[model samples]
Target chain A: MDGDHACCEGALAAGCRFVAGYPITPSTAVVERFARRIPRVGGVFIQMEDELASSIAIQGAVWAGKKAMTVTSGPGYSLMMEHIGLAVMTECPCVFVNVQRGGPSTGLPTLPGQADMMQARWGSHGDYEIIALCPDSPQECFDFMIDAFNLSEQYRVPVMFMMDECIGHMIEKVTIPEADKIDVTPRNYTKLPPDQYLPFKPAENMVPEMVKAGDGYRIHVTGLTHDYRGYPVMSADCQEELVHRLVNKINRNEEKIRHIIATDIEDADVVVIAYGITARVAVDAIALARKQGVKVGLLRLVVVWPFPEAVIRDLANKGKALVMAEMNYGQIYYEVERCAQGKVPVLLAGHGGGDVHKTEAIAEKIVEANKCLS
Target chain B: MSRTEIKIGGFGGQGVILTGFIIGKAASIFDMKNATMTQAFGPEARGSACSSQVIVSEDKIRYPYVKRPNVMVMMSQEAFNKFSPQIDPHGIMLIEEELVDPAGLPDTVTVYSIPATRIAEELGKKIVLNMVMTGFFTAVSRIISREAARKAVADSVPPGSENLNLNAFEKGYEWGLKQLEG
Candidate 1:
């Protein structure tokens, strides 16, 4: 299956029964695939008039006690940002596949871009944390969609699968497990009586049990700050507690949430950091540099958010220079440079996303970093 | 040795991207080699130029893209003009005679001209021309089992649309196998 469609199938296997999305280039195939296949599998798929409506509908489905998700590209993602922030405040569990394309505004309708990296982090208003996964290939797309859904339910926060057109359109062989082979994680519902339930109270694991509407639980949800009873409060204390729990659920689990694939970074003088499609290029550059007898390694970031600062800082403190490569013009390089903190020099290998970075271009940067050491 | 890179290009709807997918899938599934494929196409569905790149490597593929292609399958004149210059000297070129006007291509690369469209039409459907060329390429390269290519094509296509594709893939494979011996 192509990468975008693979996400749909992966979600289906993961037990996603509701999807609400607007049709947009590069991401339209995802919705179209779901529209055709989901109903046959007894899942609900809806095409909303706009992205805002799409996100709200998915949130509604989530509140109604279903594993739900939405798909969109750049412009659509922007429109849904306000609602994404709402999902954060409401503590809703859902998944979003932002198959990113070139954009500030409809920039490259059909092209690929990782330019939305920062947007995924801060596009939605307010101070809240989000779980975002960056997948490099179609197989990764399938695997990560499962991960995205799992994370959303586990943390009770809406998760983002920030993908690009390159991964979405590229077709490949993905192993679909037999019916009984799949493992699914369902949302935890309150077992307590409706009158006794505190909808916003954190469970032992910090993830709250979701009480959906019409369950006689009297669940009251809002974008405004709310208390454990799910009622809006005007006090600063309520705001602080609400924000604290919302951010801390995922933030406190950084050690568990930060996933990275590092290759040969041990005992190396230089390490290259990359994610998404650019990580693929960085791997080739590291190998080529190693062949020339340069001590080079790679840090491929699969989980973009939660930053993996500890791992990066450890590599930097180990006395290895870091080179950050990304399809955007220096979005992730800032984080690497901050972590390096003059412990090791950092280099930026950036692209504006119309084309994939050439391997030789990245290799040249690696060689230059090596020359500086001597 | 460097991994061999193949780029197949043609007007949209010629299954150029699917051709690349078969190459990548064959290498990974049948030969146990690492393979990666990427594709790009213009806005127009049929007349627009589309292409897919395949990289075959003996090692685990770290970088999943081809910087310079070693084999190029050009199914249209425009595709040839756009991509032929990047073909490495030791590479091979396969052109579809019905679609491409190969007037000035250099002889440094081993070039095979085939009437893939004519063959597909003779076999009863034009859409299977891509599968025929896929079989021909697989026959020459031995990248995957010809039987595997037939199954991959049949399995990939949606249900109820398999019989004609299966026949076309078989015809193309047999034709390609014959060329290798003759």
Candidate 2:
């Protein structure tokens, strides 16, 4: 399987009964595959008129108590941001697979890019938290889709599986473990009587138990500020509380989120930070650098959102020089600098979109950083 | 930590993608180091100018892509023309003799010409040329074990074609061992 197709397979394996998406380069095959496979598995697959409709339709499926997902690439991802914010505000548990392509507006429709790291983090309006996973391989694409769906359900938020064109079209052999061998997580549904249920009432953990529509509960969902009763409210306090609660559901649990994959930080002089398709390039560079007698390590951000600042800060305090490499100019690099707090020097290897970072270039940077340290 | 960057290029139906995965899996699963693989191309149903890469190292792999390949396998004339100029001076280049024109190769790099398609045809499996190239690569580079290559082949071949592929692979394995000895 390839990354995009694996995403569909993984979503299905994670109990996604509905998928709605537009046909876009690098991500169209996912929808095409789902069109054939979803109905075979007794699931619903819809080809929406555009990216916005596709996104909203998936959220609607989630609202009706079905696990749902949508897949798109660069241009489609741009069109879907408004509804992405809606999903965030409504606390809808859904999965989004954005198989990234080179872009600032179709820069390279068929090529890979990590340019959307910042977009995935802050494309939508308002100050809300999000969870996004970057998969570098087809198998990771398969496994992370399951994780993405699980995270979305557990936190009652949409999760983005941030893939790139490189991984999306790349094929590989993936072992689909026996269905009974894997552990699956589903959303926490409201158990209260229909009359007493408050859609916005959350537990101590800040995540509310979701109640689906048509379940005899008068569930009202919208992009506007809503009260606990799910009615639109214009009061400043109501707006503030609604946004804060929505953000806190993810923010408050930053320490508890198991989305980071950090390797060999202890006793290391340099920490190379990267994510998505570019992270794979960075990984190779670090290994090559170490061979040249530099004690370097890697900090791979599987979850690119919420930025994983705590880990970055800890590594900075440990005196590890950080190098930020991505297919974009400097999106995640800025976030790393903010988290580094001047504790360590931060370097960058930027490739706007046309070219990916070469391991040799990364290795050269590591050597330069090591020379400065020595 | 040792990092070696490899690029494998061929037509879409040549299993170029699987060979890349086998190399990466060898580095990650068998050798027990971090490995990252990336490929260029779409339209999975057909083979075009497909390319795949693998980065292998002792420590965790930081970056997954190769800027210029230290080793490259080109199974078609167009692929060879597209990638051969980028091979490092001391790098190794493997070409499919039936497709590549040796006259166009760089003087600094060592080129190994293999009759991969011919070998596969002789073994009654012409489509297994990619596997033959992969087996030859493992023998020459010793980057990954032949056993690992076999397992990768077994794991990746689609249903109902496994037996024929296994037979094809055994013939390729013997050819690879001979290349190493030579």
The best candidate in terms of DockQ: 1
Regions of model 1 farther than 4 Å from truth: A179-181, B30-32, B44-48, B156-182
DockQ of 2: 0.31
- Per-residue error (Å), model 1, residue A243: 1.3
Candidate with the greatest lDDT versus the true structure: 1
List of chain A TM-scores, every candidate:
0.97, 0.97
Worst 10 residues of 2 chain A by lDDT: A169-178
Which residue pairs in candidate 1 collide?
none
Candidate 2 versus the native: TM-score?
0.82
Task: Give one digit per residue, the lDDT tens place, for model 1 in A197-269.
Answer: 9988889978778877787988788898888887889999988987888788888898898889988888788
Instruction: Please give the CA lDDT of all the candidate structures.
Output: 0.83, 0.81
CAPRI verdict (incorrect, acceptable, medium, high) for model 1: medium
Worst 10 residues of 1 chain A by lDDT: A170-179
- Alpha carbon lDDT of residue B140, candidate 1? 71
What TM-score would each prediction reach against the true structure? 0.93, 0.82
Native contacts conserved, per model? 0.52, 0.42
